[model samples]
Target chain A: MESAIPLHLETPRTRHKRVPDDYQPPYPSFVARYKPSVNRVVMAYFGLQYRGTAAAAATDALAEIAARFAAEGGPSHWDRAQYVDQAGYENVVSVAYWDDIARFDKWFASAREAWTGAQPEGIGTFIEVLRPTVARHETLFSSLGRPEGVAAISGGMSGEVQEHAYWGGMRDRIPLSQTGPMSPGGNPELIRDGARLRVKAHDNLCLIRSGQDWSDTETSERKLYLDDVEPVLREGMDFLRDDGLGIGCYANRYMRVLAAGGDASEKSYGQSWWKSLAALERWAESHPSHVRIFGAAMKYLSTLGPSAKLRLYHEVTVAAADEQFFEYLNCHAKTGMLAAVETVAA
Target chain B: MESAIPLHLETPRTRHKRVPDDYQPPYPSFVARYKPSVNRVVMAYFGLQYRGTAAAAATDALAEIAARFAAEGGPSHWDRAQYVDQAGYENVVSVAYWDDIARFDKWFASAREAWTGAQPEGIGTFIEVLRPTVARHETLFSSLGRPEGVAAISGGMSGEVQEHAYWGGMRDRIPLSQTGPMSPGGNPELIRDGARLRVKAHDNLCLIRSGQDWSDTETSERKLYLDDVEPVLREGMDFLRDDGLGIGCYANRYMRVLAAGGDASEKSYGQSWWKSLAALERWAESHPSHVRIFGAAMKYLSTLGPSAKLRLYHEVTVAAADEQFFEYLNCHAKTGMLAAVETVAA
Candidate 1:
């Protein structure tokens, strides 16, 4: 609170240039180093228009890319629920990722090019790049291994304020243990089963351990320093998990924080990977208890103060590939005399 | 699926300027005519550092705006949830809608200024914009109030594809007929007691009238086209609602269906928006269901995919204004400035 601690960096401007590995404390404990892992992430959002019969071809190509990525245990990918604008035109958010920029480039070039090449026509990709910065990550509830546990396996998404009230009720309605258990060790298991509960349970097992704010009467409407907020949040997360109620994702005193001026780090925002939409649907359809609690939570949100809000954005994995083929794809695809010669050579 | 319809327009390159409202659809539909009636929604996401104190101020301001809009029977507003980012930071998204663009602009200007002015010393705002084009849009579910019966009113979220699976599964688990009926002229007398059940019921009871996909069969996967896919989606959605499930969201599929390209849209990549960190936190505390769903979704995503392949970005919204505001406040401000300070006749 006191003049807001000067964050480690004014803003996450250059932080995302080289994707970080893991969360680091960025702060020092009582005479010790507490560096949080800083993962570098780069995102390029594209708006494209293609020729006839290309949309399906492109999407299928993307799906293939995703399937391949899944097989390789790579960054997840998928097609957002398809949507259209007023002109009867359709579009999507092509999403892809990479731990290493070089690898990403490889995937971008090779796999992406192959997919595009298969298209009946060319695509008009967005001119401007799209990226955002991220900070203070937390995982609230998760489970794995069960039919309903798939939801828990994936990481939580960047939240919108409008939906908070609904989730608030949900936290109260569902007992944590029922959803899943807390991870006693550092490495929580991933969901191999069909359900999201398996993942949810494991996620609950792993406490936020950092970054959080608790809901206490005294702290109501009060500003908290990250130092103050983190410990309290950690304790509360542990308590929730210990009590068998899933840990929650919350930032007390919503609406009062700000990013360091001039900060520009590419952040992550969007849906996660699923074996298929079918896989996701099955988990939801079969899980009645989870659904009940989830419903009650939503109803409660509607009754809360007008402090929440909602926004939806779709991300489609327009192009993607693995490390091996990128070089020959994006980097080597040249137009002109050389391209002509290469085509003839092929 | 016979050579799908050509949905994209080959506009001149110069016209590709992506103005704020540049995404206007050339065609006409409910979204074109009725979108204005329904509030224009925005979801703002912020990182953890910003969520400390600055975010709260911004969220408070947003809540005030949402209330004002709701008072006018305008569109709804709220912040959905906080998500864990690869960059090792926590991010929150806020959702809000306004009746008229003018009102929204007024609120946005006021909020923006207030946010900047009240920004914590070190913390700044990181924001991004994600507007769905035809190629990438997801409107999986939609529900309306039955005549007078209200089946249910729940709070839910739809994450970007990169984060995790869909968050709507929460809705699937709720009991059917929890509230009264649908809307626009159904049986309003069913749950007249104003009890939770009565309130839960939809007014015009058009439960899941339609969806994007019909069945989850592999066979359906083969015919993935607007023409081929639309019918199944419609049927599936109808079944959900008619079978007691609520409608998701009336999607703008026409554009997506039209743009039959090999890939999806550009908005699929990383994108976010939020005033301050604190504001994001308040939203999280208030909305726990989102936390649970988001957390579960994220964890599930971690194992199913490779963390190394992902990329994230964070951006800040310095001066965001809509068209109505450009005409109202901006123009008026300029006019006022030009007003002849006329030699005060001094």
Candidate 2:
């Protein structure tokens, strides 16, 4: 659920505020901190609410059944949390992740039955149902706050700082960067040396990108182009990484493969946490090696196809971090909140 | 991606799969192990390939710009992953996470201009035109391998000692416990005192009861009937925690509220993870407390005017430990995964 709340004031500020006669707010409970093991599995749940009193009944029944099942012999080694709201109106998105697909599959089937069975008459009213979509990727970098000495840097080399100027403006902050090609000048200096952790998961991206045809393969000539594509593709990826451009740094170069049907369906995304936006922006604006490699890669791709049907998006994550990063990992599962600090400050 | 991969190949097989000479296999160097962090944000790109050469060109340009931008100082921190096949086609899903949103946001803006500005004329020729949708949600939970003990208990759970089970009969090696309700006596001995991670995440349930109603308020006449509700809800939650019937023993709940007008239309979701289908189940079978609470909740909700809307969902999680959990967490921004280890090295 997107967050917002109106806490009771010691003094009433708004005249329209109306407190329910029996309103009893749940007390704030302190959550315990716990470090997660590396082999853990996490799940997020997204749900769409049914309209009317029936929807309430549906949710309550679901809650009861779930609680009972847990008491019976369900796994208790993980954390669980939820959010409900009427804010989004007709659309209600419920998302939850599981430690493993196997266990998740079991929980999924049983839960479906319980929910449907509970409201024999009202369960079929859901609109816009979507199947599960999964994507896996790796983390290359992260930045949670402005790094030291960024302001002292000259030009736009402030890396993520520049990126933020553009993206934040789009999100209703302030307009600084215009919507167009970025002029080269400002570029943040890369850490000449530092300990950067790199992690990779199995087939997350490949599985999602499989079967997307950027070039027409319906003809033999188009298919032959594939032969020369491998080396170029590798070079391009290598350049992207070696240059430290980070993913999604470009506005118009977005690429997506069409789903099996002729529609363009894509996979989920990976998370990031750079040390600073200035650092991020510098990589985006001034990387020279990436410029050359990516350009060559594009030229090669154009040989098989033309430029159409493509779109691009740009976002600046001024402050960034993995949702399941160390700080997140230490949060209490039950409350969807941070736990009391033992090793780190809350 | 709903899982369809077979689980029979537990032991690694020879890596001898052949690919067409023209096949552009993704670079293996791009793959890495996953790390868990609490503060990470991902910037992902989804491109539709069906848009043809023009789309490819636009995407190429964006890629080039992104690469060049990286050269500036973005800290090479992006991973291009997930190419999903909807129907029979494919689409690309690239992701990168950051430690801070501000830094990412800055780079994101500049990149946006580069991408949008580079679009070729008549770009719509390659594919259908649809604005891409970007969504952000917090991480919840994740797991790997049969949630804690499902793997160990696979022997009794599966006479043939199969590993995993798919939903219904769709996939191979999946188990029923992970799929649906287990028979009361399925594994009495295995239902020990400690937490047993299951094969699934959330459990969705319906609260069933005879008779129904349309009430406007909890009038004085029904005060006694309402008096018994709170106990039931507490009982259910307590039972799940104490008795160990639910998956991922930890539990939490949230409430959802709509923000009056157009703002509500932009984003949608229910409160907490309970909004999903799986968590709802735990609330049901966990205990009698849930049943009582549900009855009360329904009655109370029914009094929120004739038009009050309510929905239900339940979920249970099976978490993993160590590398497995870390893999799960690093994969998503909002979800947290705890590893599943040998609770007792029996």
Candidate 3:
């Protein structure tokens, strides 16, 4: 069934920048394209929050999880990062990706048992898992050499895709967008156990991880980025964090990526949850903050031409309600998905 | 009616570093000490969270609030900062201070009406107002020149305070700590009004803002800080953010201070809410993460001696329930104090 949602037609209300049908992107950009056999992928975030005294214990717990993942049947790939949350607690997070749900379920069940069975005092643990169908997930990258986020699990890059370099290009690239408008349905529900809180997901809950890496830029470009582009980008990010609720943003976190040694790196990303893909698109396509961001980025890119070493990329997912799981132990109610859910008796 | 909480006595289970009565600090530090006539101070945080499209409207609203405060009998001092929240929304926050509650109430009533009466579309507004008795607030600074947070409204800085350079010094500096054990007594209760939610404060809710400024440091010292000190400091901060619930911390946010032009500055701070001053003290004195941070800081200080240009400061307040007011409009359930409260009908 063909939905009434317009496709690539600019109306009087259109505010986003659009390219003509024959327009070509100035630079090559790539998106992840998985194999046909990979019908879906599971992304799981295992988090450890702890006080200084529990550092050793938390580290040990993380190592155990890693070991479990490295077993006979486990996630295909995983990465770790560290950050401090709003409440001033330190967090170590490990993100694992699996192309198959059966494998993920087996590994997760064992890992969960080991993690919750013997959590040491002064440590809080949480798991946020998302299983999005292959058609529902989309990824874009400015460069081809580096693959981050869900792109790490892709079979290969879709060498120079035609959908980018214009507004609504992100939606056009998503396979599921062709079939239907991914409108949100149902409200988030919460269940409480002892010291743990679990949030059941709602359909069409959108998640996006948009990132920037200026670590490889030269002195002038780096200065230009830090002084010009970054400020505008930050302003946009700050706006979304503080007041995007009216536009259907559930929550936003602007985070700095930590290096292997737990030091803050030159890279950073904004991770946000939205009510639906349409809401996110509404903000991105026409929002003034994004326009400023786009202007700054275009100016920087044009000034530097192909020599610009800065990298930009994003991964977006819209998960089905049955394919998501969020559980938090001894954490404040605002942690992750808990913030958007209504608490009910278990 | 003397409380049984021990004062400066080292028992067999002592874990925190202590200084002898005659021991002298190697460097000078200052604390804010208001005049005897000023028995209390009011601090109000007015926040504007908005999407890019609503930026202009939000800015105007903020200006109106400032203008209202500037008019006939407003706050004594006020400052502004911009940040991104967990949900990816951008936030512009204005913090105002008043020496008299009567003056604050008078200004707030007018300001509240102007704010809530006509909030533009695509914007979310919130007010977190706190009034603490003079005896309930304490401030400490490593350097004498720069005054921040509550110190911006202090009569003057206390010259060479002796309560610092020890683990339990923070508690010792609070005047109210002398008479009673400031134990948390009540649960946070929430009241709803249409889209707005108000969280009534509990009895001894603790708030702390600990800041670090390495803006003026030389290359070598800055490297020393970023490499040696910051990693250790961040580890402690992360631990607290993730797992401090078992230790009495309610919430923690490690934030980068934005410059006047909305650019990230060379300063950052960890703002946290705790159950009580005693809970905070226990973590500071006995937590391993904090111990590591203290060691790193001491090493850096000893190495740099008097040449260290990094400035450190913190302000802590143990607020009475009646003195606190938290109200969020069109905000997620987890924003600020709402995360730790129980919701009830209006």
* TM-scores of all predicted structures: 0.21, 0.18, 0.46
TM-score of chain A of 3: 0.86
Error of 1 at B193 (Å): 54
Query: Compared with the true structure, what per-residue lDDT tens digits does model 1 show for residues A46-66?
Result: 223334556765566545555
Q: What are the iRMS values of all candidates?
A: 16.2, 29.2, 26.8
Instruction: State the weakest 10-residue window (summed lDDT) of model 1 chain B.
Output: B325-334
Better of 1 and 3 by lDDT: 3
Q: Which candidate tops TM-score? A: 3
Candidate 2 residue-wise lDDT, A221-282, digit = tens: 44433444434444443443233323322111112322333244332121222323323323
Cα lDDT tens digits for candidate 2, B1-346: 1111223222232211111112221111010111222122332332222234455664664366447446643523432321212222223322233444456556666654443323454221111011110101111111222211111111111111111111111111112222232212111111122222121222221111111111222454244333544344435544533432234322221111112221212111111122122233333322234434544554554454333322221212211111010111011111111111222222
Model 1, backbone clash pairs (residues 3+ apart or across chains), number = 267
Model 1 CA deviation exceeding 4 Å by range: A1-35, A44-59, A71-79, A115-118, A122-346, B1-346
